[model samples]
Target: PRPTQQTQTFIPNTSGGNLPEITSELLNSYIHSSQWHFIKQLAPKITPSLITSALLDLHKNPDLAFQFINHLGFRRIRDIKTRCIAIAVISGLSTSKPTLQLLKETLNSGIATIQVVFNELAVARDELRIRSSTVFDFLLRVCCELKRDDDAFKCFYMMKEKGFVPKIESCNDMLSMFVKLNRPYKAWVLYAEMFRMRIKSSVCTFNIMINLLCKEGKLQKAKDFLGFMESLGIKPNIVTYNTIVHGYCLSGRIEGARLVLNAMKSRGVQPDSYTYGSFVSGMCKEGRLEEASRMLEQMKENGLVPTAVTYNTLIDGYCNKGNLEMAFSFRDEMVKQGIMPTASTYNLLIHELLMERKMVEADDMLKEMGEKGIVPDSITYNILINGYCRCGNAKKAFSLHDEMIHKGMLPDIVMFNALIDGHCTNGNIERAFSLLKEMDRMKVHPDEVTYNTLMHGRCRQGKVEEARRLLDQMKRRGIKPDHISFNPTRLTYNALIQGLCKNQEGDLAEELLREMVSKGITPDDNTYFSLIEGIASVDKAAESSNS
Candidate 1:
């Protein structure tokens, strides 16, 4: 009674309490707040778990939910699990009726964490008994948006476990996921399941599976699947025929592909740009350049515009044939059509120029790549390095190699092999050996080409002992040597044989020659000449000694 009354300070219960009823006004306030901690702290205060009800309410006011998520403060709540669940429910409710704008926003707001929200929904499905088809459909779309096959499969199975029969659209979405994931086996299994469920497979479904099988090089299987579809009274659509034709073309069955093309016309199915593109690509592969060009012109006659891929195929084919002029003409034509050349376009041209020893032009193209904002990839540098090496410019090649390394690009085995071959051919055997050791240190396993190039160089320099040792080393490493490893010019063999014979080891040379013959290698005239000369010299020495 004598002590002064102590004043009690009020501390807000932000950590754990019954959250307030989330009304439109309260939701708006939280969305407009610049500080997410306020929302995060206040979110837990909303009572009776307002997630479902709030989501339903926001479906009527869709813009409010999006606004809340778009706010910087709301993004901070993204890290909180409960807040994330709340947002996922809101997203699921709006998924079916999503505006293009909302889909874009959802994708931009971290797809991975959005997936976690879907997982949480799946886990709590039994407890919540949430049978919102909208939620399931939305999750399927999220999977498509994120291209998450495994997660999408999990969502699909969860939907089934909840006694929700997936519609044909959902099934198609799952099939697409499988295709994107490169799982044709899983895709076919799902397709069969679709048929078992009596859900009519759409033309899109057939197209996806056929394209998937074709891409995997299962042409016969793809064709058989198409035939099976036809047997079921499912007339093959234009896409169905296109996919089969493309598959045939890719498998190098151009004639079969053409037959399919003809059949497409006979069946009153019009071939699209894709069909023509496949035909052109196949023709180009067969070295039928004229036929490929004719197909391109025929595509225009059919009123289908040639895409960049179409032009790239022709350009690549010409480049492969070492016809840079024709490739450039196609490139110019592509530009005239307002189709810009991509990095691949320049890469192909640069590669071709390098193949022709046009280093000066290749270097200019590299500069052009930088100017056009096209960053050179590993292959780009590799082409330039190989070109310089082929032109006997080892110094420039090594400089590029060092530059590539400096730029954090690891030199692949191909690049290393090119350098080694260049040094060896330039009479720098020691340098070549050094590169071989370097390859070992770098864990780049040398292939037959690497060893062969080094061995041939040593033989050329009359270092037969070293060459023979290399051959033995190759055998020890369990690397099978090719014919080039054993076969060289007559001078190389003669030099080695003469050395052996001079050292009274003619028997070994004779044995080697016999072994060569047994291996089906016909000794050249120089080989015979070397052996006869060596024997005659030996006889002369023997006669002089007798006298």
Candidate 2:
């Protein structure tokens, strides 16, 4: 709260009206007064020049200026000059929050670009004789928080060019934003820049860089980072160790993870749920379910409560191994342990149930989800939509599709492929084609699965020419069938060859074989069988024509 207004004698202006001349002293008096309504009454007389003068007058008392600006409201400070002056004044206060708030408001106000604000703030800073670069540092922090990484990067160098080094926290924020955006390369460049600038890094900075190294699959380098930190006399924290453990686990190097675990413990850094969870997940990935379960037991014995992620990892393992009994047992155990199942937990169970062709059970599980207040996410809807499609009930699949969209979930490529496959299976080639057009309108690029399904549909309808055109279109679009590693290119060639053979287009089928071989796609037994059938059909047609 501002101090009460001091009783001061005011001298009337010779050319002014009944109100006294509004000098900086009078403005300061009104600013410190508990009666802000008086200032509101004098709003008409307040101009940008008056605000700038008053800010300069109250430069030594930034708190009063901040309050005065707040009472003036951002709308009144619409001009870029006044706003920057206001930001510069408030920046002198001991707390950064008020200054940051004002700066953010100024930038978001659209009165000036970031560059303009940067320049104006510098001018205002110089006019006030404020030598500190705190205001510019706050600008970088705000830009980073707004996710304007490129703009922030430009501003960073700009500040540096002006002989100003932003505080280390601002630099870390920039690096962290790059990591969050998955632009590890940019993060590295910026990291090197920070090093060159001699900006000392914090533990948070090292942690973020370690995560980046792990993301790039440079696990060995990630481990070496701990040594680098130690050499610099910086102690490693729990997060640092957990990141490396997780990295090793992600690459299926369980032994490497074990070494890290032992090292962390020997250093008196105890393993938490996340640390143990990584091991469980890695073991599950390697099909060591029994070992993963035993690890879970050890985690519990250590008095570390397992997170939903831990339980979910175990459940997913069992689901993959087709052991629903064990999966459900873990789910029940988690609920009994007072850890409510997350949407992810339910999604896993529902996906496995659908994979087993048990639609009724999947539906029941979905109902249970609503009862338990577990809102279904996009993954949940995709699982249900796909299950219904596989069961040949396109109506239910489409109905679920509408529901998911209504719930504000955008259907991804996987869901679209399922819908297209469902339509093709039901002999609705025209509808499938329409969906393909919809994909284009929605800016969802159709992948090879999309073209493969469409080609197979056209072949089923005996529209061999359309299927062949689809193959050509696939080539034109540069859609690689094996872009998704699990989907082999052979499946694509097989679909086209079988379609041509069925339509008695043996010449086209043979041509496709040659093309497939030229692309280094070895023809499978199905490919040869389709070619032989095509040849036999062509021979029969020729004989019949001769007779």
Candidate 3:
């Protein structure tokens, strides 16, 4: 009878109706209410638990919770705990205190929070300052985040003052901070302190010190540190070798850098991207384009993808070698790899083109740069103006000059020299002098090149006395005269000699020639020929008068 009457069970819809309209004030009043039982009961059902978790979770999902916290008027929590929790959460997630501190300081100042935590921790432990390695490690991280070298050293000092022994890892962190900040002197002091304290240093510690030495251009010292590391049974990592290699490159010791690369391979320390990049840059700087290209291929064969910097280095190398076609090809290849060329890339290309006297191409490239939203910098305009001046295109050069001034880009000494040189070369000596006067008026102190060009221009017009006066002015301005500064020209000497012969002053010219010879400058064949001809003519006239 029960089987014949099958009963149907009804499921009630629980989620379809509108949720109870709970205003934020009501929810907050319920959260901080005095009634313990009611507050606990309402918290779970309302927003207290959610808000607390949300506050803590801000560290995990900062972007999502940022607007919510801003709207909720938790400026103090947003400022302090939000950053601390975020860093602590990320530190727990990545297990890298440095990276956590880096991200935390990038987003907010973790300095004050760390100081507060340190003070609280010390008081709780009944110590003058942090004594635990863990606590010191945390403080070291905050120092790194703030990039406060003095504060970092103070933390180390406080650790020692408090009779707390620092761990090797803590010492390494301090050393790394000093190295990164370019305070190798402080790093060395810390290293010696570590040795005195009998705190063992790790491979990372040696690596950081060696890298610091390399950055200071102390390659020989870096090599010695490498030996010390090896003697201590600390094997060098790729980074250690890379730092040495880069140091060698910087010192223009490409051969030494190569030796380090070979040694790294021999030691089974495989070369990484940094290793290859440094090698390539060294080769390029030495004008070994083919070697650099081969290195790029080798890097790719080693399964190391070339980054934008890698490609940019090669592009610069090609540009420097005056191979614009190959440079552009590399640029296209970089674009194919979805890499954008930076302003440096364009500047290098423009410089190369200008050096090759390809003004039209340079102008066109400048226009293309504008269309690409790349504004030309002062160097770019300088290159073009210099090229135009070299080609005797003064109008175009001056037009660019005015345009630069209009754009608020002041002309440096090199630009002024180029324009003055163009005037001298074009035989516009008067105009060149006018520009010199303008340069003085503009408070642009004349450099050696400026004086040299003006002196040479005056000598060319047979204004040797005027040239000498300018030379005196140059001395007054503290500009030293080199051999080139003396206005070298055959016509200038010829005119002076002729004037001396006309005035029966051949003896003076001969004396001047003797002085020149004493100065290690031989008179040209033209000078000798002019002297012989003048003497012979004078003697012939004397013989004729006597006859």
Candidate 4:
């Protein structure tokens, strides 16, 4: 016999002598002997409260408890209360893989739906519903773990609909999942439903909602929710402070983030590395490198270990400031602290080195990175290709492109754009066109920049007619060309008109002049200068030939 406490207030049948108490010793003995039929026979008489009490006692005897939980897989049990208890215990078990697999097979067999199980719980009785909510909560987690999101969500909604209040922790898990899936709107809706149902929320619940608000870019709403938390007597933790701080930082509101840091300190909450990292990242983008460096030092002085992301942010700041020596020193400091540099760290360094036109040093650094087991991604290859293009080495750029392809990296639009722009700048219209064809075959849609470069290259090679057709093709593809694409500068108009006139296509030049006029741009003296001079020079050459 178990000494019963008054923990289960809604327990039935005891005061009225309707249900009899079954001894824990007898239950344990039956389970230990593997008397499955006898266990099933006694399951109906077990009240939900008795089930709850027995669970607390079962942990004392490991072997009996193991067999007891395994015996819960029986499908013939008719009592809703006992079935809920059995499934709940199985759901909460930390078992081996085989046990879990068997549990999964058993669970998927008899239950038509999670709601059907919930509906059978007799929730109108307060004590039974209170006892049953745990099982439903555990089942919801099981559904979530199995990636049965639709069923999990339905089960949760049913909890609210059936007048059964869900546990705060289970609600938080569901909310966290919605946020992870980037479906914050659904989380917000569920939270609203939770409020309407009078389900009590904990501090963690508030923090989860705050993070969702921040992630959705509702910064002001997030702050208002923080105020609401204080009003409701829910003291914000460091996680709450960190989430709002990061939100402000993401929006480039550096001053707002700094104010949050001050407020957190005044409230006696110590900011961790993550809190400082957000402010540092924001300051770096605003070009306030000195303050960002000072914050980094402050984080160290506070005895909080900075993350690799922290060092990477500072490194990027120095690199963008054209302070290569400082950036290298930070990289060294990171290594000394036993924080290995990530791919982002090297990418920023290599990009800046290439921009400074230090080709030999850049190549050596890339080779060194590879030797150190850092595989370069597509972004690294694109930067190197763009560097080669800028240095008028289209051949080297093409070789890098081929190497990236050999490494199984599908070239992105930026990669294709760099190569196309390189060939165009080299006046190799044929190669540029071939690359454009490759882009089409790869299903990478060309943006406005692609067509602008190709048109300019065609015009440079006296293929003004081809350039005009490419512009039309851009429109047919539903791409709205910028001024540089179709309505180019007066210089581009001059180049195209000069090329057409030089080719002895005087009629084509007149058509181009009329077309340029239709684009709402005023033709200046320079535009006519190329057209008039080219025609005059061509006529003079024709007269000389006749003589």
Candidate 5:
């Protein structure tokens, strides 16, 4: 017979629970025989306090305690103390999966702050007399997985403060998160902390640091880091070689990338698809298309299949160079090689078609995309929207915009800019302003092109004051005119000056020309022409008024 249910010996953790009491012995008996259905019958009688007491009684038997917790259900075990004790029991098992999972749930539940959870975990760990740091490590692992860097850092240093050195894997997890978050300085700080704590670094750790260095444009430092890892007896894997190769290629140093490639090959590390892909991308960027094609062939000879990205790189290069015939040929070759075209592939081809003003061909490509069941992503829609806008088809462009939204795709700033430019081109300045307002409502911050388009539109409508105000608003929003692409900026200024001059504001036009020059933007011939024409007209007006 089961042990008799005891009288209420423990108070509830919360006011709502008036749970019937079952002693640990009875709970333990029901759990021992795998009679979970019997224990579950007492669920209406169960509270966090009862569960914690039962867990403490079964601390020596973590498996049964875990089973009991699972039977009662984690959702019922809502309190922090109960969850923490449950986690501590699970941590006693050889595998950390259940422990990590429970900790992740606890953290994600948002019922308790990370600090409260950590505090409870520490207390539970000490009460259970478990000497392993597995629970803390799991906590950090969960934090890293959640991308909660600050919480992970708190848990890490908290463990260190309590004289518990986290394992290398935990440190690496946090380090990897910091790198992914693009917080390089924080990553380096954590690395230095790891060094100070004498936690041995792993290949994964060194790889993350190398990636960080490459992202920071310290390619040489990244290479030297490889030698540093070797000194520490950690061998470089294929990922290590690929990282440096990618960095070199991205920096336009083909010879440097080739040196790394040869070094990897000498070390018996055969180049993979990514290794060759970098070279293909580099060669394409340098306009060596034929060589890139040959490299793709070389990749196939080495039993490596090139990805759609590799082919897309070549197609984009050809498209940029106005070689549509070759671009289409490569697209056909990819299909022949059994590599189906991705939405990106169709996007590239359709974009090029539109760039060549072959609207019919572009539409045909879009139809092919649908036939292949390749759904158009945001880039595809942006391409088509911009294309139709350029062709003075605002009605069609707007129709596509509605279709995009109906398809659950949010219009990006590029789409908005294209629409604004189209409205401006069609002399629909009021509609352009409406779009700008819509951008504000959607919280899409306008870039320089956005403001530039509006400013030009205002100038075109002879609203010179409003145009000047937009430039001021742009400055106030901290969006500077793009100095790299000075032509558009120079055009904006010329339009504004011409508008001012037409309003017989020659002095303001000259002042703006001086401002343009002072900003190191040379006044082009159109700039000088606007000023000259303005001054001549103003002089003629003054003489006519005197007559």
Candidate 6:
């Protein structure tokens, strides 16, 4: 069979301007054409499409096209569309190998750099007063579209310096780029410049600012901006409400989000999936699953389908609460509805199973995840290692830790702490110290929890002096050996005190009590009650049998 050659059809402009078919010969005829000769010859008859075709034909030798276009000038090409297309052709060629070669040649010349040449080209648009600004606008728009933001920024200020108003859309793109890069301050500077330039602010511009304010946790300011929007006669769209709602939800101001939701209704704007998703996510984070479920029902009533993310939130919340059955049930439900479970879904289930010490079940979940085409990541390995450590199977834990490293996953401090505490609990103090040495070699600084775990282990083994030394080491590390700083809660102190009392070390227990009081950690009723019982048990004081 003969191979069929693929061909493309050229479509002419709908307007009176027909796309000219310019061949090499047609373009070559203009090689010796004098300055203004081609412009005067093709006057009134030349269209943007024709000029574009001529430039494309001369793309190999871009200098001819550039020099010729420069000579023709914006005044001669009075059609704004013609001037834009003429520059558009050059912009398209700017990425080509031939064009880049020409650029390098042009830049290598000490007399003028590529930037200088472009600057000269950019300013030539000001030759005619009316078409001047539009020329730079065209150039700026092209620069932004090509992701030449640096050039776009320079051109923007150049327009301001030259009194030529750059394109408002280009300025907005620049602002959008800054916000996306998390340089909200830069966005603000550009926005202020827009104000100084008297450029009309679009709704998109205000929405970007509102989102930035929301991300910065300035909820009240974000909401106040809504009034500013309405005051300027710019009505709030669904996106505007959604951004504020999401912000409020993330800030744990679910109640405020409800107010925004009501405001959206009052303004005749319908809440979308994003609004409901944000509320559900916040509720799930607070372990308010029942309310999240109610919101889920509300979402369905509104005819919006919950995304996988929505289901993941519920699943994770249930998993954290030890409601594994419900978590798996939601996973099944999401699958039944054609929303396949993601790796996060399996991660939650596996972590909970590991926490419960159901190693067999966790292994089964790993296999299931593999069958479902979900790859286990670092979190999966960490959970498995912690699970083995909890089972006192240090060998298995070390094996999994090695596997994680082999798979390019670096062991973090959490993994090391788990191993260290595991060895300490098994009374393998030498092995624990070796792991600490390895941690130091890896440059993973031991956190307060790590030190606290070691201290509790030593205190359990009646090595009070060693445990006390660890506390001093913690202070030397610049980590204040405070009650809360040692561990996240008061449990560490209570456990240490109980262990000391059980070992007949009432004096140390009293010292800990005094230290707790001196540090201003108010002893709760349970803390005092535990301490009294510990002292009585340690002193072997017989209680009355009459009761």
Each candidate: what lDDT? 0.71, 0.86, 0.68, 0.74, 0.86, 0.72
lDDT tens digits, residue span 55-92, model 4? 54553453455566455433443344445444444433
Give stretches of model 5 more than 4 Å off.
1-20, 35-41, 110-116, 458-490, 503-522, 538-547
TM-score of 3: 0.61
- Listed in order, each prediction's TM-score against the native is 0.68, 0.85, 0.61, 0.72, 0.86, 0.65
Task: Write out the backbone clash pairs for model 1.
Answer: 19-45, 19-46, 19-47, 20-45, 20-46
> What is the C-alpha lDDT profile of model 1 across 1-547, one tens digit per residue?
1112222221234565665544545754555454555555665443323333344345445456555444423433333333433444454443455432343344456644545655555544433444555556566666766677776677666666666656777777888878887887788777776676577877677778788888888888888887888887888998899888988987789999988888889889999988999999889888889999999999998888999889989999999988999999998999888887777888899989988888889889889888878888888888888888998889999899989888998888899989998998888989888988877777777766777778778767766677767756765676344322333334434445555554445677787688667756677876666667768778888899999
Backbone collisions counted per model: 5, 0, 0, 0, 0, 0
After the best TM-score superposition of candidate 4, give how far the Cα of residue 85 lies from its true spot, in angstroms. Answer: 12
lDDT of 1 at 230: 84
Encode model 5's per-residue lDDT on 60-97: one tens digit a residue: 88888778877777855667877888899888887778
- Model 2, global lDDT: 0.86
The predictions' CA RMSDs to the true structure, in order, are: 8.6, 6.1, 14.3, 10.0, 4.8, 12.9
Better of 3 and 6 by lDDT: 6
Model 4, which residues run further than 4 Å from truth?
A: 1-89, 92-131, 142-153, 181-184, 216-220, 426-428, 479-498, 501-547
Model 2 Cα lDDT, one tens digit per residue, 484-547: 3222378888988998888788888889899889988999999999989888988999999999
Model 2 residue 87 distance off true place after TM-score fit, in angstroms = 1.4
Which candidate number has the best TM-score? 5
**Cα distance off (Å), candidate 5, residue 351:** 1.6
What is the Cα-based lDDT of residue 16 in candidate 3?
35
Instruction: Tell me the tens digit of each residue's lDDT in model 3 across 191-253.
Output: 888888888888888888888888888898999999998999988998899999998987779
Candidate 2 Cα misplacement greater than 4 A, ranges? 1-29, 41-44, 75-78, 110-116, 150-165, 183-199, 406-408, 472-493, 511-522, 541-547
